[model samples]
Target chain A: MNEREFLKQYDKTAFDQPIFSVDNVVFTVANGGLEVLLVQRAEHPFKGHWGLPGGFVDLQKDLTLDDTALRKIREKAGVEPDYIEQLETLGSSQRDPRDWSITTVFTALISKQRCVPTDENVSSANWFPVTTLSELQLAFDHLEIIERALKRLKNRATYSLVPCALLGETFTLAELQHVHELILGKKLEAKAFRRRVENSEQFEETGGMTSGRGRPAAYYRLRPGAMGFEFVRSV
Target chain B: MNEREFLKQYDKTAFDQPIFSVDNVVFTVANGGLEVLLVQRAEHPFKGHWGLPGGFVDLQKDLTLDDTALRKIREKAGVEPDYIEQLETLGSSQRDPRDWSITTVFTALISKQRCVPTDENVSSANWFPVTTLSELQLAFDHLEIIERALKRLKNRATYSLVPCALLGETFTLAELQHVHELILGKKLEAKAFRRRVENSEQFEETGGMTSGRGRPAAYYRLRPGAMGFEFVRSV
Candidate 1:
């Protein structure tokens, strides 16, 4: 038979399918620490437990997996992320209680000031410190998902300007370093960090200054059209 | 209802599901170039067309996505990979003709010497040079998937011992550099490359030497229990 004829006679329901879904681990630097946005599940199969913002893919609405992930982030967290990328895909028969399931995970970075968590389609949405995540009772395998996202974020911060997404529109180098330190959970050598950032040429002086305890620090912002710049060396 | 009771009554078939499958972009350094493994489809819709080795996920036989990918690699390529990692997940309505489909892509690296391609469930299995991938009429968005995997492999080669997987059990530093150059498509500075490799401390002298052109090059192999080592700087 020809290709078209074969497709026409294909039976898609001949085999069992897994539950496919998208989940977003939205992150921000707030309250002197890294925080993740999570929603309290209002439905069964881990009701009332905090989980990453996610749901089943809507075949009619989502044209791609990214659309499903962004839709979940906006609907559950009430915030549009500044930076997002696919972290990893996790699947198994034991992860979810419903059935064999697979979830494409996305890691998103946004400023906490821009997020206004809404209680729509969920019990509540809130930001919790990543350091204390082990103390909370989370839904499904979300704790492991968050930990994986955190590891990726920390690794990227070592050699890329990924943590800058958590800062405001304009900020000093000191502020940028602080955000990186929060994500990495360690302090970087100041001179080496500045050298790496300056060498990347991804940032520019905004001709402004911040009046802090030390000498007024010059403000800077990402160079126009610059995004996801990586350094040749880690700081 | 409680968690167990809720799962018992959950209707898994309520929503239309997408066809889920796993594909492997197996890479090897052979014939002095980077090559990818391709299998000719034996069944319709795109029968007779060359595509990445893949098939629909068998829910009963496969316990995880990685298992599905490995099973496809073994069945179609007839080789076990030395290194494997998830490249990305691609899904859409237009990619598949039968129904909405999603595929998790994996990037695998193995030496050409170890692979013995067999046509068990496929019409034929062979290796094609990556440089000529554009000329071939591939099936089911596989060309794009392969390109994405190639980009990732190239990126990882710059700062990690990733391309070493394409080498045999033991090789010389010169042989390792040749593999990296093939993947990166550029000649690396000898001193810088040696510095990065030595600094990572992932390889150890195998006490063997290759008697080639000028001098006898010492052979080396990965340190015991050493894997996925990343450098702090790009070579």
Candidate 2:
């Protein structure tokens, strides 16, 4: 049928409604492994269970999904993060109990920062290592969300120095390598890693030095506007 | 606030409702360039305008986002695609004039196959080259979605053998290179590209030969269940 024929049969309101929400997986490096920030639910649906910090998006106020993510982080964690990326969208009719909904998952990075729940629906906010996340049951499909975020982080770490977001403003080369090792789950050759970093041209010297014992390593920071490195793998 | 205290102040119904939808960017390689499948709208908002082939999710019956995508393609187009990946979600309050809405975008690749609109809301379904997408005024924010999908395809081609989806079931190494060149928008080195393809270990010989005038190239196909390649760049 032509455009006119199709127009006559089209119904404008033939669509179902669904609630849209945002969930955040805030990751930070602490102790010796990667940790994710989670909040305890206080509602009847798996009440008192652990889950990623999240909330329903206010369509009247939030302009974009990114805005909703930032707002939810602030409302739940009480701090701004350094890096945030849209990880994936988990949508299904049975994922949420109250209504059919879709949740756009986001992955954020912070440097061992504290997150305190500003909302009453959440009982507690704390960081848990990725290795131990499987032991505890998370509300909703949060466990799957965290797993996807970790996989994305690992893939991104190959071409980009994104794991540096887990460290302070300035860090030593050894500290940087450790972050990479923790995220990649493998020990990298120190010499090859240094060479790849220098070739990427994404970092600059901070004109400072580490004051700890042993040989003082130079403090280097991500360049002003570096997006990612050129190397795929170094070790 | 404690979890108990937070739960007291939380209102489950305190959220603004928005319309949720899905849009697909179906791409294929034909006539020496990349093409995208589009449909002419027959509704009032953008009657007679071109847009990505898509529709709203049915919360009443649809189970998952992936299912919705598959159904939309089967309903809008007549055939199923070989590859589909979540591109990105385009969300905003002002994007839709009739109502506030958010649409999750998906990118799909198929061999040069035909697609016909099964719904009347779409007058015509046709494929347009990516290079000439700007010449046509697409409805809503589809232009942005197509641009993003093209960029994603280029990046994904660097790491994965996704471009092979655009070719037929059996193809020579040279035909495969041509597909990569079209997607990457650049010519690649033959010797290095071959070495990289061999190292990826994602292809196997079919023991068939191309029946052409000149030297017959050996027909090769993607190894059964080959996900992605390891080569980043060889040119």
Candidate of highest DockQ: 1
Report the number of the highest-lDDT candidate.
1
What range of 10 consecutive residues in model 1 chain A has the weakest lDDT sum?
Answer: A114-123
lDDT of 2 by residue, B132-170 (tens): 888998898899889899999998877678888888888
Number of the top TM-score candidate: 1
Assess the local accuracy of residue B162 in candidate 1 as a C-alpha lDDT between 0 and 100: 83
DockQ of candidate 2 compared with the true complex = 0.39
TM-score of chain B of each: 0.94, 0.88
Instruction: Kindly report the docking quality category of candidate 1.
Output: medium
Candidate 2 has an lDDT of 0.81
CA deviation > 4 Å runs, candidate 2: A1-14, A113-123, A227-235, B1-14, B114-123, B232-235
Error of 2 at A149 (Å): 1.0
Query: Over 4 Å off in model 1, which ranges?
Result: A189-192, A211-216, B189-192, B211-215
